[model samples]
Target: MAALGQHAVSKVKNAESQLVQEWIAALEASGGTRNVKGDELKADTREFLQLITSSLENGAGTAIGAAQWEDTRQFLERLSRNRAQMGQDSSQTANFIFALKGPFFALLQKEFASEPQLLAEQLLQASELFDALGLHTIRTYQASREAVIRRQQEELLELSTPVVKLWDGVLALPMIGTLDSQRTQVVMESLLQRIVDTGSEIAIIDITGVPTVDTLVAQHLLKTVTAIRLMGADCIISGVRPQIAQTIVHLGLDLQGVVTKANLADALALAMRRLGVTFTKAQ
Candidate 1:
């Protein structure tokens, strides 16, 4: 904590500009500046240096979790998030903080050259503080990455369960993957909303691209069909290939009330007939 005292703090404050330059250089050499503009990088280094000096002057010690280090934490978190968004890994994000160690230690060594013990103490304090900040940056970066991944997964789910308007008062939802509870929920929400928006009376759930249909998947389809009936829309389950039909029979899964079709064309024709729509062949 003695590093927060007047002597060490003053030295850092007076050498802040030079420290930022050296730190930026260190960052550049460590590949921390990749994909970052030089001017923006310099600004960040200067701002971080100022935050550190200000925290030290305000008696914020090596314990980065203290309230006095709030600004520093905020800065590191923002930096970490930006780096994560830029597709940088945790090590690169952490290097942004760790690179400062070299320049900071050099500054302390030069300033406290006469007092070897004091120099060692200040260096230790700087090392611990920087290490803590680096770890914080890594944690924040990892959280940001997880958030990005979760959002992508949701987007993929929506993409996979696309609802198309196959005809007037008819909608088709073609599914392309294994049915899970989460995807089932997404499918229900999207189809139900489309039904409401289009006032559609029929929705065809096409599962030809679905790799397999176990008991759970059958249950999911049943739930979705039940939901569609509650919304006053009829649902047709399509893509019941021969293999799937055999599997359904083997599983003894009941589908007494639900309508099934063999493919998209048959489902669309059935839906069109239900709507009293007919086609004529022209020669």
Candidate 2:
């Protein structure tokens, strides 16, 4: 009974010491913002440190979900020194790296003695965590990156949706971005539905915002034309800029047999003529 009581007391003291160290580390983690480059990066690093400490406390580093952080430490050490570093977001990673060292190594030498799988999983998470926090720290390729990712996701959602008609029978789709295969699918559906609902034989596709059309864009356009034809409508490719035409030819991509016009004016004129609305073209 006496021996067990002494062991328990020792454990309690160690636990108390660990708790004090954690608060100290947390304070330091928050204070090291000067060495960090940006306010956003500093905030992200601080948040990541909190998450690491939480995970360690949860036995996530020593138990089945615990990650082996040896490689992560070495990786962070390299990141800390590299100015031309590809992994800058992880620059302050070292600050939080050694914070959990004592507990992890103690657990690593014994707890994970036979649980290699848990070690592997934890290592995987460490890598993922590194990346999630890494983006915010990078100096180069930083500013527009966040916005670009956001726009890409938004554009992807937009592409999956069909076009809505503003008129009773006439259909109009104003495209703003590149027409990739994924987005082209949405555009095709919208055009087809409008033709069926209004019994309209003509659809005007305005592409004033499309910067350049590559092979994929050309393929998407072809697919749209095919779908519109099956729906019994005449599809017009409008707003074909001079530079876009040159790009199409430079790529050696064939867009032959597809109806195209110099601008929406010419396209609408031809569509109106097809619908039996004839107008005199002045010489």
Candidate 3:
């Protein structure tokens, strides 16, 4: 019985020796190898695994040293858990286990025999986590587009303004606050619709209460005028502030044919003259 046990141990150790040598050779062939320290660590890990396997085969009490074995076991458990938890934000990536290749394990043993695999696991997890984050971002952006469209619709609804028809053939829309392209479009549509409804050939766009103007507003103005002209109507933009005029000039905005007046009254008078309609003073 004793002889048989001794022979079994020798066979196992001899086979393990060749495996250890082959592993070292393969590790050397692969670049990114540690020099002398890595060799020493590999030797230690090989010895530890061999002892554990031999003990299992021999019915010995235990092959691994109490402290070292416990520590290594715990280290592997933590490494696996941490690697799986990488990209923890992704609901789909939970509870994943790393299917480490044999070469990968050998590399780990060589480089990280002394310490736990914390750094390696963390690095791996971080890579996956970024992927998970990218997926989440894509999903968020997809959802946000619909939200933005809905918000745009709500904004269009809120852009409803008050149009005051001051006369039979003249109408005034006092645009208060700022005007963006969308709001300007809404305003233009409302004015055009009202013009058609009331047969008002002259519309006064009073901008006295408008906070400021930019190129976008100027462009919207151009579009509004074009639409009104298409409808056989004319628009007189009134209350051009000095600053707004300067900005338009500086931006090289050409309002060559678009009529502009000094104030709302002037715009109304211009509108009435073009329409050949006059309001007489009571005698």
Candidate 4:
């Protein structure tokens, strides 16, 4: 790709304010100004225009991957990420770059009116440069969105698995939702960490909120029980509704070594008995 002509660079530098105003107008017309503040938009537009002019003056050609365009690339990347976090989609983010095309083309046409060939060359170079930058913005936006989603998923996993201290030397983990390998790992880690932290000898896993008991869920329960024993703590499986018990029996799943109770209250009672904790009824 050819370098942007000096005439084009000078045109942008001379008419920078007009070009920014026109670009911002176009952006607002396209509904790209919904989430962004006016002051922030003006500052970003000014900075971007300055970066573009400086890059063109420094011989940064249509190939934005060149070392001379690194600053411009970094600026666009930051802009894209910010827009993504602000809930702007890829099209809106890229529009922020592409909106400048009309204002710039009008400037180029007037600057090179007497020379059509030079005008076309500069226009083509400018188009290529802006297109490349817009594409870079979209790619950066997608990556940032993916990062945000992954972080939210991690937070959800942590929120879904909560360990409670039921009594002295007793802990309870109330699980809801489907049990997958990823969720199972989170459950095991949270429960084991609580056991170590509290020095609790007994753990009650209450699955009253869990919708079903399948092989995968049973395996996850077994894994949690094994982990508890490894940490020198006993685990009782609770919330074994009649339907779940029937399902377990129908599937021929063996939970022989694991102690299970029909409800959380019974599990708590048994756990207290094993821990030798006694309570008296009030008159």
> What ranges in model 3 sit over 4 Å off?
1-160, 279-283
Any residue pairs clashing in model 4, and if so which? none
Candidate 1 residue lDDT tens string, 84-133: 99988888889998998998888888888999987888888889889898
TM-score of each: 0.95, 0.48, 0.44, 0.96
C-alpha-based local distance difference test score of model 2 = 0.57
Candidate 2's C-alpha runs over 4 A off are 1-63, 66-166, 193-200, 214-216, 246-257, 273-283
Candidate 2, 184-242: lDDT as tens digits: 77677666866787887778787777888888788888888888887777778889899
Against the reference, the lDDT scores of all candidates come to: 0.90, 0.57, 0.59, 0.92
Clashing pairs in 1: none
lDDT of 3: 0.59
Cα lDDT over the full model 1:
0.90
Which scores better on lDDT, 3 or 4? 4
Candidate 4 stretches with Cα past 4 Å from truth are: none
Residues 1-283, candidate 4: write the lDDT tens digits.
Answer: 6798886798789999999999999999989888899999999999999998998899888888998889989999999999999999889999999898998899999889999999998889989989999999999999999999999999999999999999989999999888899999999998898899999999999988889999988988898899889888999999988999999999999985899998999999999889788889999
For residue 169, model 1's alpha carbon misses the true position, in angstroms, by 1.1
Could you give me the TM-score of model 1 versus the true structure? 0.95
Write model 3 residue lDDT over 1-283, tens digit each, in one string: 1111343335445556655555555545543123235665375447544643454345442222344344434433342333233322222221111111243345434444566654355335323533433343334434444565688777755555667798887888888877777777778888988999999878888888777777777777788888889999878899998888788889998985888876888887777777788789999
Model 1 spans > 4 angstroms off? 1-3
RMSD list, candidates in order: 1.4, 11.2, 18.8, 1.4
